[model samples]
Structure formats: structure tokens, C-alpha cells
Target chain A: MSFEPITGRYLTVSVEGAPRRIYVEEAGQGRPVLCLHTAGADTRQWRHLMNDAAVTASNRLIAFDMPWHGKSLPPEGFETQEYLLTTEAYIDTVLAVIDGMGLDKPVLAGCSMGGRIALQLAALHPEKFSGFIAIEASDFQPAWYDIDWFHRPDAHGGEMGAALVSANISPFAPEVERWNTLWMFMQSGPGVFRGDLSFYTKDDSLIARLGQIDTAQTPVHVIVGAYDLTCTPEDAERTARAIPGATLAVMDELGHFPMSEHPEGFRPFFLDALAKMPVATAQAA
Target chain B: MIETFTHIQSQLDASPHLLRLGRLFSETVLIEVDGDEYYLTFDKGRIVQVMQGPSRKTPWRFALRTDAAALSEFWQPRPAPGFHDVFGFVKIGRGRIDGDILCLVKNLRFFKEVLGLARSKQEQAA
Candidate 1:
């Protein structure tokens, strides 16, 4: 199906009593599907999703840049230096976007860091989302997963980003997609990636709270790339088994950034998940 | 400026992160800077030997060649685009990697992380 052109907007939202400007992009005209990006990445990851007929024609596809990411600048008086992403801050930003846009329990879909937060939001506030689609999301980061290499001053700018992109993405991914992903990685502001990794590899947690999710109210689906070394298919399966009624699917030959690495390549798996969503969930949204 | 063999050795030894990455491989790799060559002999991921001015007898499994300026730029605190990666350098004709594509592919991250130790040294000295 042909894709629709997406329109972008800058919304002013209040955070911690301070006004913050966030960039949100949208297409289509039905129920909203709030798309959250992976840490250090922006809404560009969801461009293909925003354009798809399955989403745009029948769903309100919305994606926003988190604070200090993409077009969303840091809040007033906030230091861009030593920037770090915190669970509370990230959740607050997503909440602000939802409230600012007046979205009602939109289908929350995210990859990696976005996936983890979607899971958290689903459990902590199941009523806030109609469905949770977690991609490359895991319950816990292995203890040995150390990001200290990024701490070195040298591990900034293009070099660090190159290392990260190489590690996260599979070598067999399409060359154009690989370069596109690398382009996005290079545009990241200094310390932004390292800061995001703080949450991805450190802070976020949902192991003890899986039971909080009421699947009847919020259906949770997970898809992990078989080639995703960071959050392997095994990790997704384990997490899926922990949450009652949660379903898991493994996307073959795909890596961590399935949606962005090759959006066309990732579409089938995503469409399959979309088809599995309960009919009532769409009606409810 | 030509980086002293001892300086590179010290830099690698000082970084715990680099050490962890290096420990993943046990191979002798040759690095040619300008016309000069140095052989880094690794024993189970540790830098066991640093032979200056080429190796006469040992057969290296992998070799990378680049000029001093490119190497220097790569070791900077924040390297620019072409200097940020080995393959990137090769792509731009500033560097080349040869011999054993398998070994290079298998331990690509290890090699990248370990070589990044040069920049960490500058960070430490600062």
C-alpha cells in the first residue's frame, strides 16, 4: 500500500512545573498508537510505521522525541552536559506527551528502551494503554553488561557511536539500512547515548511487577530479533513466560533495531502482531 | 608524530575495558603506521608482545595499514568520521585491512574496543 505523508508539530508541555517543548509527528485519523523510540533515538525510527496503511489508514500514528533527544530540547535550566535518562524523567516525558496530545490509552509500541518503558507503563498503569508491543525489550539486563567503555572521553562522538551501532546491529542487515541506522547514531548529541544506556543497561526494572498487568485489559505482545545479541530471543521468551497470557514471537534474521534497521523487513512481524490484537482493544481505544 | 611502542603498550595495559575486550582473542596482529610496522602478539587477549619495526619470523593472522596522521586522528579524544572506525578508514582509502576476514569479522568488536584504548589513554592523562 502507498504511504501517507506525516505531519510534524512542536507541542509545549509542562514538566516539573517547567514548560518543555517536544516534537511530535502524526499521520492517519483513528485511534492513536503512541510510538516511543529507543534511547538516544528519535521518532525517525517509526517513520515506516507512521506511513503504513495498516497504521495510518485505521490508526492515529504518533511519535515524539523525548527530552534532550531529536528536536526536543532539554527543559529550561537543564544541563545538556552530563545528560542522563532516568526512569522517572522518561515516564514523565511520555506522560506529558499523552496528556498534551489528549490521547486515550493509545496502543503503546516501542523497541529496546522504548519496549522496556512500554512494559513498565502497561504494568504500572495498565489502564493507560490498550495494548503493549515490546520489541527487543527484556525484563532485566544481565549484570555483566558493562557500558564502562563508553565512559572514556574517547568513546564519544562518532567513534563511540560506531562501536555501539556495530555491536547492536547485525552485520547481515541491509547495507542501506545499516548506514541509515549509523547516520541516526552519529547525530546523537554528546553523552546522550551513554546517558540512555544508563537506563537500558542499568535502571529500568519490571521483574517483580509483571503480575500488575491485567492482560484482559492490556494485551502485551513481544517480538525480539533472533540476531539481537543484547536482548536475545531467549530473554524475550523468558520475559514472555513470566507475564501471564503474554505472547512472544521471534523475528528471524533481524537485530535489535528491527523497525529502523529495515522497516520494510520488520513490517511483516509487526503486522502479524497487529492482527493478533483483540478486536475489543481497538473498539476500546 | 610517531606514537612510541611503549606508549601504546602502557595505554592498553591501563584500560580495564580494553583489557576485557582484548582478552577475547589470542592472535598476533600487525599494525603498519606509515612505512613502519609493529606486531602486537596477543596471548589469550592480553598483549604479550609489542615488536617494533616488523616481525621477521612470526606469521600474523591479520594486518591493518594506515598513515601516522590517520592513526593519530583515530586516537584523538573524539575522532572525526573517517578516523572513527577501521572499516571506515579502509572505505576512505586512509587505511586497509587484509588477511583472515573471518578472524576480523569474528572479533570485530574486540578489535575495535581494544584499539579504542589509544583514546582512553589521552583521556586518562588529561
Candidate 2:
């Protein structure tokens, strides 16, 4: 059986100053959620969730190519995960897209790298969002991260930028190996490596800065695949622990992508997370 | 306020002690519910000093005038309770406080208890 997204496309937008083509898709509406992808992958990671009743019944979900991959191409050398994932640049592109759509602060949801961006976005500008949900966010525990692994010698981070690009954002990848190949391709691109490095070796102090997100009253959902090695189960707890009153749900027998690996697993949690946001908002006062 | 205090981070309310140990507070903590700030000194995630900020009664800055003696009386480490139990405390009156208060959960595992899986499928296969 092949997985397909209900609404999908290679769209374009001029946000974060540079005009970039972003792979995009939009479906349903109640609340809006900006879906984020992993370092090397495009929005395809969230493809399974689009048709999910939990998502469709409660909110509008939107996802697009990050600056350099998919339909949105960043500069040839925009390799700074620090820059690509910075709250300023990341927020600018998202807000631009939001303003482009004229919607209020939507629930910012992402997994792994995307989750890192979601955390920063929530922290830097809590006023702009309704709530945030993340799956094993990288920035969740910045202090514990192993920075050296990102730069392993076998990892070709700089030279294959172009090939890495093609592998990452292609509209259609035929098989799981092809998809996995595309997912792993980021290690070869200079821009994505820096982005990965930025993710793994951040100085943002999210560990200490968690209290700043004010989750005691805000609804933030932190999800983790029990067997996710990329970020690991311990890392998920660290992230969940960082927020006050934030919901932490660990998927059993689940790997990296909860929304994809187990839609049955993630659905109820997604609905619950959605349900929690409004109460969080009402309670925030 | 400090004498009535307990460890009051955002992660405390749903912490594991309630499920595994059938308890919420560790024997040590006294609690204060002022406004935004939640200060705690713990032994096993038990509340020794929960210096919460002012309730809806005053502004968050009120925690500044904390009762030092009561707070100091409870600072020690014990096996932490469920880390998430602070959620209830935060929800009660501190619900709107800043995100920084979540730091008080001494041991993360108490709150981050993973629900499903006793063993991995990959392991079972092996």
C-alpha cells in the first residue's frame, strides 16, 4: 500500500526576506497547525496525518518545504541550521505564510528538527501562538546533546549539497529505501549539516529556559516514539520535563515518526492535544 | 507562606508517586501559592519548600517577599516523586505563570513515565 497526502503541492512564498519555493499543502480547518519536517526530509513525514480524523475535525494543517528543500529553495549556501532554524528566520517564514493566509497563531506542531523550531518559536514569541506540540524535539534538551555525532567522518556534510537537495524534496519518491535514502541525504549537504549541527549543538539553553515557555498554563504536547534512536526516549522525557503541565505521550513499539508509524497511536493523542489548547488559552489569563 | 509550601514546579501534579507509591507529596515539602514563581527544595521529589508566587490575589512579583526561614527548612534531596505532579499545583492558581517554573521537577522520569511497552518488538523478534 502506498501512502498519499490528501492535499499536496510544491508551492512558493516570499518570506524571511528571500523569495523561496515551498512545498505546501492545506486541509480542513478549526485550528491551524504548521507541520514541520525533519532535517533532510520534506513535509512528507506528516503525510499520514492529513487524513486523520483527529487532525481534520479539529484544525487546519499546513506544511511546506523548509527553505532549502522541497519546493522552497534557500540560498545555495544557506547551511546554517543556526540560521535556518533560528527563531527569527524560522518565525519569519512561518508568520509570512500565516499572514499570507491571514490566520491567527496556529498550533505549531513538528517532529524532531521541526519540533526544535516549534519550541523556539513558542518561547521567543508566546504571544503569537495558541499552543505548541513536538515529537522528540532536538532543542528540548540542548545540554545533553551529543554534538560530535553530527560531524562524523562518514557523514559527507558539505560537498554533495546539490545532490542532497534533489534527494530531499523530490515530489515523488518510489519506495521506502528511496525515501530513507532521501531522509539520510541531509548528512551530505553543507547547509543541512549545519542545520543538523545547530540542532544537535545549540547554545539556546532550552534546558534552563524551559520555564520561560510558561507551559503551566499553556498547552504544549510533547510526543516521543519509545524506540526513536535519532533523539532517543530519554531525550523525550527531558523535553516533557522542561514544560510545566505539558502533556507527554510516549508511543510504545513506535519509532521516529509517530504520526506515520502509528496513526492509531498518535490520533487520540493529537485530538487530546487539540482539546487541551483552548483550555490552556482560557486558563492562560 | 513557605511553611505551607511544597515543591511547586509545573511538572509535579501528575508525577509518578501517585500511581506507584499512592502519594503526591514527599514527606518533606511545605507549599506557598503566591503568583508565578514556584520554588522548591526536595528529597525524593517530596516538597520541602514550595514557594509559589501569589495567587490571583496579587501580581507575580509578590513572590519576591518570600519567607526565607520556611523555604530554607525544606531544602534536601530524596528520591523524587512523580515529576509531573506539579501540573495540578500549576493548574490550580499558578496556571498562567511563566514557563520557567517547570524547572522544579527534580527528577524527570517521575513525570515523563512512558505508558506502553514492557519490551521492544525488535527485541522480541531477536
Model 1's TM-score against the true structure: 0.69
* Worst lDDT 10-window in candidate 2 chain A: A164-173
Interface RMSD of 1: 12.2
Best by TM-score: 1
Worst 10-residue lDDT window, candidate 1 chain B: B1-10
lDDT of each: 0.76, 0.52
Q: Fill in the DockQ of model 2.
A: 0.01
lDDT over C-alpha atoms for residue A100 of model 1: 90
True contacts kept of each: 0.03, 0.00
DockQ for every prediction shown: 0.05, 0.01
Docking quality tier of candidate 2?
Answer: incorrect
Model 1 residue runs over 4 Å out of place are A1-4, A143-148, A278-282, B1-126
